[model samples]
Target chain A: MHKTLWREIKKEKNYLLAGKPVPRLLILNAGSRNHLIRCFLKSWAEQGEIIVSDSYPLAPSLYEDCRSFIIPFYKHKNYTEAILDLCEKQKVTGVLSLIDPDLSILSELKTEFASAGILAFISEEWIVKATFDKWEMFKVFEANHIPTVKSWADLSEFLNDVKNGKAGYPIMVKPREGSGSRGLHYIESEETLISVWNNAIEPMLIQRWIEGRELGADLYFDIYSGELIEFFIKEKLKMRAGETDKSVSLRDEKAENLLKRLSRNLALYGPIDVDLFITAHDDYLISEINPRFGGGYPHAYACEADYPGLILQNMQGKHLTEQKIKWQSGHYMMKFFDMVFIDDKTRRNAGEEIKQQEEN
Target chain B: MHKTLWREIKKEKNYLLAGKPVPRLLILNAGSRNHLIRCFLKSWAEQGEIIVSDSYPLAPSLYEDCRSFIIPFYKHKNYTEAILDLCEKQKVTGVLSLIDPDLSILSELKTEFASAGILAFISEEWIVKATFDKWEMFKVFEANHIPTVKSWADLSEFLNDVKNGKAGYPIMVKPREGSGSRGLHYIESEETLISVWNNAIEPMLIQRWIEGRELGADLYFDIYSGELIEFFIKEKLKMRAGETDKSVSLRDEKAENLLKRLSRNLALYGPIDVDLFITAHDDYLISEINPRFGGGYPHAYACEADYPGLILQNMQGKHLTEQKIKWQSGHYMMKFFDMVFIDDKTRRNAGEEIKQQEEN
Candidate 1:
């Protein structure tokens, strides 16, 4: 790790000597199991050190040759100013966010970074809001003539529409700002819809049930040239708690074309993980658009596509060349396993239970 | 101005009394145009005190209400720490950039702000670069499937394409990173293209010229909802060096829809000034996208649309319910006039020439 850091520092000094600016990328909310952030930090650490706050204690993977600082998490008024001071002190050239809630904060911080000639990746506030909201994403899809499952803002409105044949039974109901699938449910009858509506919030959307299995595509685009450089599509073979547990990559030309058309219509520039349902009629309807890095992003990394590297290049005002995905062509599974230290008594009880079961 | 300041302060106090968070915006720059800075200070002084460096003389408009300090512009290593100290002292809640180069600096400052839960507007470094480069903008358009005039990276490449019938004459040439069309030229043939390219050190792009009168639209969108709240479209009646000399607001449904679509596709939020060319064949192609406040933004203000106010609302995380725009429908122009304070001899010579012309 020390050797890597020394080599990176030497490379940066060489670039500086050649009059080429080397951008220092700062990662906020650094501790995550997501492969995108890990790969991003690893690649970036090879170029320059990343400054991370002390809040992230578990994931030491990102600490390899990178500097870490203990700082308060987002909730204080001084946070933005503190970051500006850090960038100035360290000569940080860029900033990146690996989580969702931090997107808005990143957007706001971009302006401050700009005054000092540093770079940050944040969209306009409204665009960030629209892309974050499920209902708003649908509105943009509708406006751009992109096909999507029929959706409504309120459950009552959805019920009325379904009763009047505007929507159908077996509709999907979920919260407007929920993560995972904790509150999501499939309703097959009027009674279920009424029950769900009574408990749900005022601004929830109801959409038609997509018939086929779930699939996802991770795509990156050049904001200036509107060129699609890398794409990875995977079919979810299994899932646990709304997170992909196992998936298989498929080379479907139709899906690729659909993604192209959707991105073209939306003029998206950054990383986009789109969820689609291939229906009974062989049509694809977008279920959701995650504009930032998604949970199963490691799957893309496993396929040999470094999304964070591409993003870093874009931030430095460099054009991206075509990068081919060396996809691992087989099923991959991720299991969430936990370990706890057990007392001797508990261990004996567990052994006894196992012996009893074996005897039976 | 004093009266307005007092009233705003009283209003802000009332808001604070009612348990509402008083919105505070921070500006980071090395001081430009005293009049413009004073305008912002006057407005802010009504609600909150202005903060600036003490090295520069305080503008008369902000003398009493503004707070000035001593700080280095970009030389400090611990700039983020210094900003945090300032924020702690002033209790700031938001930030804004008063200059172009400051955008990147602001972006880097977002990380600290995110940790503190404050809001900002500058885009991240990647987004800023994509929007700032004209050639990259075209690439993004193509990647997103938005139709734009044909463009090439260099004059030689453009000429070769033209020879092969891949391109045509009467092209538009400009520096990829130029502002206000300083090095922009309308090339009638290869001769002019070569001449313009040879004279400029900046990288250039040659685009097929869309022959028509220029039009610009300044629009703001609800980032969360992807809804257009305020829009202003106008025809450029006169221009001096790339700055609009005169313009008149016009209502065209087609143009309005096109702008809205473009904004959604780009996931654009905040202030966007789009330059367009409506071809003789009635096709509209994007000339450029400025992801910041334009010189003629005040025209939107005159039309009863408070764009800056919308930005403030988004910063405060407040939803916009009703925003109306009122057009006066008459010709309006902003002429760029120059003034020179010179010695007696030069002034006398210029005065005589003006007097002679007037007499004749």
Candidate 2:
């Protein structure tokens, strides 16, 4: 918290602008994010490079046509050290993660990472932690008058709302800190609600069920100005595994304004994806904000959102201009399955011992 | 259905023996099955050819480096005629569907398909329809003394069993004809059971909850012998979107015998995928049977099960000898995503009209 240390860290964050002609972006826990990694590689074509690090040696992205190596599991004692070493050795200028918990972990190590001249593309520590809890996030949105769905963490509050006819049955009950549709339930009546509440082993958050279209937004902001540069919106047509499987890009003034308001209230950094549901009244009720790249980022990249390119320019100390991003409005993104193959003889060149122990 | 037609169909099934050098294998509804199709193409390199057919032009498999075209949707009045016409034109000797409902549809048109010198690899029509209903399938299993999961379709029957202390709480409620986890609920109390039952729009089947390891078996039977040829077993390490994401090949004698018993109870032909649950007592309870290729089939292919090669050999009039399929055990199969780029101008050459109408 010293003033001198703060100044030094800020200077180191823009280290690439000093002299480096190319930037190496490290994607950690790059598990099946081959699509996102490919987008980075395509934009960085001959000027820069992309490096992937995952605890598992067989992560599909590791075997991609790029420099990849294994790192200790995120929970390991030497996890931070492994990343610091990789960044230093590979000359990585900016790093990002694909997992949620790792957002706070990476942000909390700002001093360590900044001192090494590597910028971790994550929000502040408290902001990242706040996004993890649904109840806390709902309160944050309500406090700022941001549009969000009605939620209740207390059983009595939910029952009182029902008694006063403020809410009705056919609601959602899910873990307070859940993601990707796991541990989520749809209660059609009071009987199911009571039974689910009594049988819960963890704190459950309840919300009014919205029967409308779901939207996923990928927002890109300027590093220095902290101004929204591009907001790519997509209407999720179908979902598989709680992730967007098929979507079509669109431009909605109402949704864009809500996202801008969210940015003003949170002061979040670059490249965050948000989930929202539009009611019949056309109100965009924000559900959650993932302060990291989501699975649907590729859709934006496919539509020429150019987020990776913009981030690289920012790391190079380039001031981005606000422009009318001319993205295609009716393009559809359809996702499918693909795979790679490797044998036992072809194994990791780094962190082999650590990976094996953690995998067991 | 006549004796003369039956005799003529039997003769036409062996049409490959009439001096045809390379037999063509057709895979219908080949959506995102690039992995499985690649296996077939690899084995048929110079000896045979692999053809793909689907109703949608943008199907990822249709864009692969192989002969692909779109047909009418399976529900079309000329669906069977279209497949027959394609088989006659492309010299396709063997045809197989990758969907459950299409099995009976293709098999019912046996005379038409056989007349075109194409053998559809599906079980008899009755058997394929039997697998669609969970309650009926359970009764079939019980009558045949096959090891299967206990199911209750009638609410009064379930209640009587509960009163008799034969059933307990923490059960499962799902659609009677469901597959792959949709509409499935884990009920922990009577209140939830009654509530979920009352709100059901369709018949929901109840089942005893089993806390055990889930396994997926890719069974390949001989075309002529009607005997199990190769049973590729994989323990599902993780699941995504109701499909196996990561699995490891394994050998379990108890489970193999149960699969063998299932083959006897139902004379399924060629390739079939079955799901099983292993209890603490090591009892392999058969859950459901998908009478077609499954998503986890690539795991079997990666382990060198070589079902595609075997099926091709059968089509070429080469009788396969019973041998121990030496697929490597303990090998892990992890799946990831990859994609291809196609602009609007590079649209499908065939079935574009049909595809657009259906997509709308």
lDDT of 1 by residue, B1-360 (tens): 222346445644654655755666555552422333344454444544444432222211122234334433444675556656665555566665545665656666766776675555555555556777888988988887776778889666777788898888787788888878577788887777787888888898787878787888887766445466788887887664456655766777777767756745575556667888788988877777766566666555655566656766676687665365565444243332111112224323323432332343
- Which ranges in model 1 have alpha carbons more than 4 Å from their true place? A1-15, A41-45, A54-62, A264-267, A321-360, B1-360
**Model 2 CA RMSD to the hidden true structure, in angstroms:** 8.6
Clashing pairs in 2: none
Q: Output the number of the DockQ-best candidate.
A: 2
Per-residue lDDT of candidate 2, residues A229-303 (tens digit): 888998897786677777778788888888878654586777899998998877789999998887888888887
- Please give the CA lDDT of all the candidate structures: 0.62, 0.78
Q: What share of the true interface contacts does each candidate keep?
A: 0.00, 0.40
Per-residue CA lDDT of model 1 for A1-360, tens digit only, reads 222446446655654655656666667665433334456666665554455443433233233345544334567676666666666765677776656777777766656767787666655556667777788878888887777787888766776776787878888888777667757889898898778877876456677878887788888876445567788887886664466655666677777777777654565556667887788898877777765666666667666667777767876788876676666434242332111112234334334432432343
Worst 10 residues of 1 chain B by lDDT: B335-344
| CAPRI-style docking class of model 2 based on DockQ | acceptable
